[model samples]
Target: MAEKKTPPPNNNRQFAVWGLIILLMLIVFTVAQSGASRPAPGETFTFSDFRERVEASEVQSAKIDIPGGVVTGKLRNGEDYSVNVPPVSADPAGEILDGSGVPYEYAEKTEPSVLANILLSLLPLLIIIGLFFLVFRNMQGGGRGGAMSFGKSKAKLLTENTKRVTFEDVAGVESAKEDLKEVVEFLKDPSKFTRLGARIPTGALLVGPPGTGKTLLARAVAGEAGVPFFTISGSDFVEMFVGVGASRVREMFAEARKHAPCIIFIDEIDAVGRHRGVGTSGGHEEREQTLNQLLVEMDGFEGQEGVIIVAATNRPDVLDKALLRPGRFDRQIEVPYPDIQGREKILEVHMRGKPMAADIDVKYIARGTPGFSGADLANLVNEAALLSARRNKLKITMREFEDARDKVMMGAERRTLAMSDEEKAMTAYHEAGHAIVGLNMEGSLPIHKATIIPRGRALGMVQYLPERDQISQSRQEMIARMAMAMGGRAAEELHFGYDKVTSGASSDIEQVTRIATAMVTEWGLSDEIGPIAYKDTDQQSFHPGIGRGSAISPETAKLIESEIKRFVTEAHDKAREILTDKKDDWIALAEALLEYETLSGDEIKALLDDGTKPKRPDLSGGKRPTVSPVPTTKSSKGPKTIGGPSEA
Candidate 1:
């Protein structure tokens, strides 16, 4: 093992060293002054003799003369001095006073000379202390914080008791939680495994998108371990200096060693462990050095004993392989978007302290939020509670939950904007078309709610909540979904004629196009194209390069386009047939939507059952049935449901 380099002294140590140096200087001055000031052995001389001695030297001319004494002029070699001569009678040696006696007892002190001597004596120490402070401050990274404390690592210490969150606190992610169970056991009772000569893994890497509970899992491990946890960001190890990042890495490991059987979590490790030489730059020395040191600490000659290093990163593909070898990051756990059950559990966890109305259902909310993470669910609950509070409601209602989900998914509502009656009817029909198609189509995803209320940049939206998380899709299911996506525009064309077709289906069109293109070019589902996937030059952005089997001719492209259009046309015709047969049902749903503006799946299914033959409360007048307008484009007004079926 290489000897770790000692970091430079911190401020407290620097101040202590300076204090000791000053104390030593004062002691030396005291000692020298005490010894040198001892009285000379009975030596006395009259001022007259002093003047003669001064006159004989080269420095005598600079001396000043005073009253009752003979003194020379200003001296050349030394600074000017005024020396007062004692009376000649006071001199026991009786040396006759010279005619020009020098007054050597009194002289003005030179200010410049005193200052120069003091500076000369202290200059080197000041320079050294200043330079030391400069390096330390630079290493520390200044920003009005304690920038001079370079040797102190910037890691947050979390002990089991200090962290209020245990594994039980992190709801959802059952599989991930199960995967971490062994880790918890390893941390809690290392001797159980090590007694059989089993070595514990040095690290585990959590890979997932943000807000997927990566950090929460790490905390759970620490809480389960019941040991010290050191938490820090990957950027905390970096510094502008060449070796500061490496220095921080060394210090962090040293700290972890102090508390053995500990867990150290570094969030977003890709900041320091990016793949080397993949980009234009050869490699960044700071990050490289930090990662290198981290590698060494993980499995160097002196391997990390009883220390587990866990890290989380969203982009694990860009990390260096050396840092992810077997001894290090031994297990890679993925925390993906929550499934339906997981989402329900997560919602329950987040809804703990809130007062919910009886109508509020966790399962419904879970179904509505198809792609929400645990954190997102928590945020949704909190946002709903906030909305309830804002409305001065005593408890959270289902309306608030719905509004919160919409706000989170599609941004805030734009209620103040005004729309023409025609536009409102068009948007209503557009969204109604989507809801009807999604409900009627086989293998279509379940509809959560449909609304014509403008939100975000959309004039209207139809939200379909998946029953569960699906990792794989069948070709039939994909086609059915694409057709459903295109159903809004197709419905507009069939019912309202071409005049009412709006660009409200832009997103839907894009989705359908990509699905159709992929089916023909990548999925090899086209019969004319055979089993070979056609190489799409446009694949650089959307499709992978290797999926293409051959270059497609123009004829094949034309055939693919026709096949796609035929598929869409058949789906559209099927929807029209279903609607035409159930015109009364469609009108009932449209009227209910116009009244409430939204409805859950249960409400819609109930409507579908009784909608076809709604009984009238009044039948006293014997009359032929009145045929209502089909709510098509030619009908400038909204559809009316008089609770009766009309002939098609």
Candidate 2:
């Protein structure tokens, strides 16, 4: 276990220094002012002495005199030690000064009003000093409550023992893992490489989609190297004030240097490293200046070995090219979604502590979740555990796992929602269209489940499981997939006509649109845009510019649009025809949905084969028999409403 940290105690010596300085200054000022205000040693008597003598002459008073403007008085022999000055003649009992240091002329004290004078003299200086201390405290990280820590980087620090995330902890992206392993070794044993005149690369960049384990890989690198790790988000380097961002970058790098052989991981570095000269969107001077400083530090000539910079970004396209240069980034590791085996391994790692039933098939779950990333898998297990807890079960069963997977992929279950009879019928037809079309496709995933149940925001959903994980998708496979996505809307148009088409198929429409767009603009599947990608490289410029190797004018744009339209139209036609031919199967599937409000993959397959799902002979207990088709897209209809571009 990692040790807990405690704050350092206050310094008594520093406190003493300031306290003594304040005391000495006060004493010096008092002594100097006292000397300046006092009377000299000796001088002749003046008019002041005559006034005192005259005042003393009137009888009971003692002798009095003044010299150098200072008054003196003595008591008469008849008196003890007191002396008195006579009052004015007409008012003999009027106020007067006695020789015991009382005022003679007025009620208030005259010359030697020492204490008040000293305080009066110190008042201005004290006010100035008070204001100075206030300003001092403000500048010295005091008086703003916790505001002073605002500029500090909020990056978390992790070491080998605290992190415990080695390469073994991260699954999938085996190639990327292998590359990062070398980076860890380089950090640990730099001297060995240096003896052979080889310097370790200063930085590595991980570029991939979100939830692909980029940050996790960084932690693993730290653990494998067994060194101090400083982790910060790219946004942490930016601030409202100009130059503050750059200053922070400098500070971060400087702090990392103290550890020498350590990793500094900046997640989402594109926050600061956007292409410069793109105007406002490149971000303000703060971000730009920070990027400049980061560039300098990463590839600076005063190169330090064993100090590595690791950064992760999902959008590498927007990043500045200068930052990605050889000397700066040095290596670019792509962390993509896992393959079949990789997903199984990832699921296994996350399932370590979960109480899963023996019947839970990792492969089945992995196949159903085609595009899931490592993070998504982790979330799946967590969601399943919660579902199990909610049901008050001893352990998580396969059903709970299925619900958890759907909940994570889709939104939460919308149980309170009630669908109208018309809406339910339309959803059933829509999902059944997809299932039937998918079944007819030559090489598509097998249907896992088809249901019109309102889980998530969708009125209906279909899940298809690939017979096995596919590492690469063929062009035919992509087209077949797009056709299945269009089936929902196609069925609505077929049954209710175009006028009755509902927004229920909006998601399906969006998926098809993207696929169609990618085909023409990205993949060059259209002959009109043949073998060329028209994707705007310079997103900095708003207007679309000319493309290379082609003279595509207004007519070409129309042609491209026509190709996309034709592609969707053909897919829709194919779905309508398939569903029409499989009308009996479609009705049977819909009836099953109406009865149960849901259907598992096997149950649906059983419905297609016979009129009902058969019981599982192997499994015991009174549970309803859930069918399982020997997974094949050709022989079986895939799940109902699931269609998307596969992550693999």
Q: Number of clashing residue pairs in every model?
A: 11, 8
TM-score to true structure, per model: 0.71, 0.73
Q: What residue pairs are clashing in model 2?
A: 49-66, 447-638, 447-639, 448-601, 462-640, 462-641, 462-642, 602-627
Candidate 1 structure quality by residue, lDDT tens digits, 347-437:
8888888788999988878877777888889899999999999999999999898889889887676767565555555666666677776
In order, candidate lDDTs are 0.67, 0.69
- The 10-residue segment with the lowest total lDDT in model 1: 639-648
Best by TM-score: 2
**Model 2 spans > 4 angstroms off:** 1-156, 161-163, 278-283, 469-472, 497-499, 527-551, 613-643, 646-648
Candidate 2 Cα deviation (angstroms), residue 76: 32
| Candidate 2 lDDT tens digits, 1-648 | 122142443455346547756765776686657445244233334444534644665223322222122333333433223223333333222223443333343232336357657765776686676567556545644411223444555556566665377888889889999888888778778877878997766789999999999998988888887888888899888876677677777777777788778888999999989988766543477788888988888887777556798999999988999998888887899999888778889999999987889889998788778778999998999989998999999888999888887787656667577544566667677788788788888766677777676765566787777777676767688778878887787777777677766666666766776677678777878877688766545442112234332545666666667777877888778888888888888767765665566677778877788776544342223332232221111111211354444310
What is the overall TM-score of model 1 with all chains considered together? 0.71
